[model samples]
Target: MDLQAQIEREGFPPGTSVIPLAEPGGQLFRATQDGGTRGLELLLTNEAVRMYGAGPSLALVLSRLRERAERGLPPALAPGVYERQVFVGD
Candidate 1:
C-alpha cells in the first residue's frame, strides 16, 4: 500500500513511531524521531483491524495511523506525545 511505500520511501515524520497499542497478531510498525528521543507511538492495530480502502495489511495500520493523526492520539499512546485507536472489534 501507499502508506508502507511512503514509510519505506520517506517516513511518517521527524518524530513518530507506528506501534501496536493492541494488535491481534502482535506485529507492529514504529516511526521514530532523531536521536530516538521524542515521538508518537501510534496504534498500528487493535482488535480485528480491517479496511474500507486497500489490502489486509496496510488497511488497519494506515487507518489507525490516520485516525491517531487526526483525532490526536493519547499522550501515553506512544512513548511521548503518541496516540490511540478504537479496537477493530470494540
Candidate 2:
C-alpha cells in the first residue's frame, strides 16, 4: 500500500504512525508516527479501540493510545512519534 497516499486518504499527518488519537464516532483524531519508518505502519483506529484487541498487531500501539486517552485531549498526547528509531527490511 502507498503510505503517503494512505495518509492523504485518512487525513493523517505527513510525517508520523498513530493517527491523532480520538474516541470512535467522534471528531477527527490525530496521531504521530515517525515518518522515518518504512512499511505499512498501522494506525490505531476506533475499531482497535472498541475491542482494544486486534491480533496483537499493535500491543505497543494500544499502550500509546492509553496514554492519549488518559490525557483527555487530542494534542495533549505526549511522546509523539516526532523522532524515533525504526527498522526496515526487504
Best by TM-score: 1
Q: For candidate 2, give the lDDT of residue 4.
A: 37
C-alpha lDDT score of every prediction, in listed order: 0.44, 0.37
Model 1 lDDT tens row, 5-54: 64544334434555434345434554334433433443434334443322
Worst 10 residues of 2 by lDDT: 81-90
Tell me which residue pairs clash in candidate 2: 16-33, 17-33, 18-31, 19-30, 19-31, 20-29, 20-30, 20-31, 21-30
lDDT of 1: 0.44
Top lDDT prediction, candidate number: 1
Candidate 1 lDDT trough over 10 residues, lowest sum: 81-90
Q: Quote the positional error of residue 59 for candidate 2 in Å.
A: 0.6
Total clashing pairs for each candidate: 6, 9
